[model samples]
Target chain A: MVRLLRFLVEPLVLPRWWQDALLLLPRLVCGYLLAFEFGAVKFGLPWSPPDHSLGLFEVAFWFPGDVASYGGLFAVLPGFFAWMGAFSEAVGGLLLALGLGTRVSAFLIICTMLVAIFMQQIQQGMWNTLPAAGFLWAALPGLVLGSGRFGLDYILAKPRRHEHV
Target chain B: MNTSRLSLWLSLGFLLPACVQPAHNKTVVYLLDVRGIPNVQQVGLRGRDNPLSWDQDLPLTPVGNDSSLYRTVVTTRTGYLVTEVKFTVNGEFELQQADNRRIAFGAPGDTVVYRARFNVAGSLKP
Candidate 1:
């Protein structure tokens, strides 16, 4: 048991940036898959309810009037938020794929995921809750490490603009 | 720049659906402005057995009447639900329930049921 624990905690012998790359690739994939799922469930060729989610109508009616009202903003905002959310997830997913401005895109997507979880999937319990939290966790690592391997950030780190042969 | 333009078009696409009315006749208009708790469930009133396929699963607002109360409506040919809202939630937001004797429109002096849980604010104009 102690040996397994030590192995798990042991410092990676690989360069720091390589470690970042290993961590980043999986996160990028998860983010992309999650975004695809969001679009499929909400706006694909045939829209379907999320695997364990309540319908939009049901979620809207669960809150107190004043909060739900949004003082007349409700008429347009929900749709707007939905659009923004889908777009963010879709685009953020792609950007993360290439490791371009990953931190910023992930942050925006993290906020979007939070709104989705809170407004639509709160009752969905841990299954829904963990994915939303995962987006945040994945994002924090990007913010800490910046983009990795062939990313715009890495390219820009070159001392001169025309460094290529 | 190309990506941004694509995003802008997608934004417009998402909005287009909300602006137009869906073809499915009698619109189940949601009256209350609550988030998270839906107050309207549009069940089809077709055939004698199990008209409501709970699979459609429109969330209904639970009213705060002392006793259990429910309201169901059949859709007109136009597909508009001649909606009958029921109010039957318990606790601080309790509301008086309307008589459940008949499934038709209530006449003057007859009990009128509100079709969801409600707080003691915002009087309806009609």
Candidate 2:
């Protein structure tokens, strides 16, 4: 049993760089699809106000800091949170695609998704919840798997040197 | 493939700012069903820095007896119910009537909610 298991799994052990490349493919594809799918809709541009088609709950994360309706505690809270989230998903997804800053990008994506989940759960019964849930489901595993197999990180693999006599 | 991914991200970074711009104020519309009667409410500009303050309510323009569709314009300092901003029901759904109307606010990201009581019914045209 040991021999069989080793034979089946041993060849799969890839160098760190290759591991990263392998990880990059799916991340990049899925990230692009999500971005494109969301971007295609005429929701609103990144810097401006949201549309009514999007409920306050939907655009909860994107609300800007400097532009609060009432000036109490949550004044800039929504906007700042949204700003961070948009940048993360947009840039983080892109980075994941490139495998350039895989860890950082994945971290940001994860954070954004978490915020999204929080908003959805708090708000409750919003259509936006599904996408957030879906992304989170896919992203956690991707984060664990990481960029592997055939990524740039693979090229940067440490060179093996011969020991001097 | 790795190089391709790198290029894709680099290009996206350059394009992001162009795709997003700050709104003069926030624009939010709610197809709310208060009790059984439907009401369309439009919040003009959500303002720049305050969420609570941005909750300023605009006039509820009655579009139909259903009240699911209305129109208004809003901003931080001022709001015009008819002029700058306009409102109309995109469409209403019987099946989704149970589901709330969805809208986006503040920044343009993928977020939408279906208000429980409120339902989008009919078309904006009529």
Tens digit per residue, CA lDDT, model 1, A47-92: 3233213233221111222123433543445555544555566666
DockQ of each: 0.05, 0.06
| Candidate 2 Cα deviation (angstroms), residue A61 | 11
lDDT of 2 by residue, B1-126 (tens): 699998875564444323333333444443333344434234222222323232343344544675543433332221111112212222322333232222334443322222323233322321
What would you estimate as the lDDT of candidate 2?
Answer: 0.43
Q: Which docking class does model 2 fall in?
A: incorrect
Q: Hey, what RMSD does candidate 1 come out at?
A: 16.0
Give the TM-scores of the predictions, in the order they appear. Answer: 0.42, 0.41
Please give the CA lDDT of all the candidate structures.
Answer: 0.44, 0.43
CA shift at A148, candidate 2, in angstroms? 0.8
